[model samples]
Target: MRPTLFLICPVLLFLGLSYLLPFLGIVQLSFTDPQPGLAQYRHVLSDPLTLAVIWRTLRLCIIVTVVSVGCAYIITLLWVRGTPVIRLLTELCIMIPFWISVLSRAFGWLSLLSNRGLINTWLKDAGLIDASIQMTRNEFAVVVGMAHYLIPFAVFPLATAMRNVDERVLTAADGMGASRLRIFWQIFLPMTGNGIIGATLLVFVFSIGFYVTPALLGGGQSVLLAELIYLWIFQMPQWGMAAALSVVMMIAVGGILVALMRRNAETAK
Candidate 1:
């Protein structure tokens, strides 16, 4: 017991100093404004710009979560049902995109989606549109960029869950005259329910706090919470406001984790 406690104490101390200490300080800063109180949290509730950014952030997160997870689910199904060689090749293809730095990925999208981009060039040649379509510096670009980074993340949790699903059960059902659709609905989906929930939670949490992808893709237009916090601190030097924004982000992500864990626990039964 003494040895175990000694081992845990240092880890606990480190967490306290790193995460807990800074968080508590921020909470204190949020309250003790120019003076001290609940003003900072109130600002979170009342400020129009903050509210708008938070709302847009939430909207983007929901759409990204749905699209990315759905895409991953389909890809994972194909992976699980494929031959070993096919699976290996597919995974290699997916991981190739994953290995590239995110910044580079965003830039790649820029080349594809810009006004004079490859897509527009092809479209113009094919008479799809009379002029080059502008896809950069807007909500469209933000979602595209975010979804690119998020898809791989969505794939792993979902594939792990899908992989763990008992294939024999589905096979047995098919042998007994069940249709593929029914078998997938009845057996496959339920077994992987926890993974779906987990992946959605993980993706949503990351999406809400995402900065780089949206910052580059959306320009300054589609400002999310993380970028808002960054703007407050670096661009505007609003330290007090920045600390308050940071606390809000922490709380929001923590809330996502709590919901994810609760759903997971319920599914365990």
Candidate 2:
């Protein structure tokens, strides 16, 4: 036990320095800036634009999480059902995007969704539409980019959970004449709820902190919390306000994690 604890010490220290230090610094700044009061936080709460940004962030993250999780679930299920070669191909496809830089992916989406993009160009050549349809710089584009980024995150957790489910149980259900839908609904979903929840949280949390995709694809219309935070620091030079908003975002994510943990604990009990 002592050896194990000693071995873990380095990891713990790394986490403290890397994560805890920055978090504490943000907390300190949020309070200390502008003479050490809750004024920054008050401003964050009172400002209508800030509130709208928060709402938009929540809405976008929720949409991204749902779509990513649903798509990942389907992919994972298909992976389970497929032959070894197919599974290997599918996993390769999934992992390939992750190896590529996120900025590259976002830029790729930009090219695809822009008015003079490949799709619009091809459509115009084919005479599908007289005018280029607006695709980029909108909520739809933001969600698509975010969901594409998050789907891999959702896939791994869900696949792990699904893989852990007993093949014998599925066979038994089939032998007992259970329909495919019934088997999935009754056995698979209940057993995999933890994975689904984990994927949801992972995707949602990451989506909330998205900066590049929304900035590039969202334009003026679909501003999110992360863009607002960036604006406060670099553009507006509102350090106090930025720190306060960061604290709020941290608390919101932390609260969600805590709630999920507590619910899981209760369920375990």
TM-score of every model?
Answer: 0.91, 0.96
| Tens-digit lDDT string for candidate 1 (172-223) | 9999999988988888898999889878988888888788889888888889
Q: What TM-score does model 1 achieve against the real structure?
A: 0.91
TM-score for predicted model 2 compared with the true structure: 0.96
lDDT of 1: 0.85
Q: Model 1 Cα RMSD, Å?
A: 2.1
Question: Any residue pairs clashing in model 1, and if so which?
Answer: 31-37, 32-36
